[model samples]
Target: MASNDPDREEEAAAAGEDEDTGAQVAPIVTLSEVAVTTGEEEEDALLDLKAKLYRFDKEGNQWKERGTGSVKLLKHRETGKVRLLMRQVKTLKICANHLVLPSVKIQEHAGNDKSCVWHASDFADGELKEEMFCIRFGSVENCKKFMETVEGIAESSEKNEEKESKDASDAAGLLDKLSVHESKTEKAPEEVPAAAVKADDETEK
Candidate 1:
């Protein structure tokens, strides 16, 4: 017969290995710690952010951000275009419920004929009140292209939202109609038996 031993030694060894692995892993991060900025000066910072966000996942480190980072201007840079420097500001450890990107509003610069413009309105920084903080330092082609890309994404999102809302409303209406129909069906009068009616009629005659 084969041995039914518990393999105590092997189990202990495996438990020890698990403890060591856990120690090697870094601690979980809080949401406040993640930040999105206009420009990140070092690649290391970006790497660190990614590690904190995706550590729970099994995938090897990806260069992409766990949150959304959009680049919207006129275009990707023509002959003399300069890219905008953007960064993220995090406040707490990221969880499935919380989005990777912060919720901030931003606007582009408004100039008669200027490229490479930065608009304070494009950013969510509340203290900067004046419109002058915006700038345009990119080429018109690049700015237009960037804006179009962002607009496309926004349009798609809006469409999805609209569709979802419409579906929900339709479902609710159908349910209401069904409920009404069911109530009417249940309240309907029952038919009298023909034999009972005939017997009563003969008795009366």
Candidate 2:
């Protein structure tokens, strides 16, 4: 049986209106938030300039522009080595999807009073295996920032490796110490039993 209570009906109506309002407003709020976040991300990406990527042409003996993109560092999971990954903005038939330059070597050179040049070498098996790639930034500040970022990652990786090596050495030393202590304990038990046997023999005589 339904009771026709005026207050209860008014409360029910109010709840329904709230639900309707929420349903109408939720999409607008979500869309606005998403728009703001996406805008910020795009702006941040733009801050990383889309510089021209060039590689040395051995045949022509000149640096040739391959594509335009931002350079990124990729770390190998198994080997824990940092590799240079060039993400191309425009797709090129000659270039791979992402140009993977493994074991990259970076060198910075001063171009002029205003600009700077960066040279990246991709090596394999201790030899220069690929053409030397060059990056020319418009200003010294940009070039320095790029170089510092790369150098920071390399230094971090080296520190991590050193820490792991030191930890392993410490663990080995601890195990060796435990083994020596155990051996001493076992020898102590044998010595005590031998002395007890000698004392008993002397008492019997």
Per-prediction tally of clashes: 49, 0
- The candidate scoring highest on TM-score is 2
Alpha carbon lDDT at 128, candidate 2: 44
TM-score (C-alpha, index-matched) for candidate 2: 0.48
Q: Work out the TM-score per prediction.
A: 0.34, 0.48
Estimate, for each residue in 1-205, the C-alpha lDDT of model 1 and write its tens digit. 6555679767877898777444466569655665766322321211111111111122543322333223222222222222222333353322112101111122444443332222222223323232222223235554455444434534554566687799999999999999999988886578999999999999999
Q: Give candidate 1's error at residue 58 in angstroms.
A: 45
lDDT of each: 0.39, 0.56
Which window of 10 residues has the lowest lDDT sum in candidate 1? 46-55
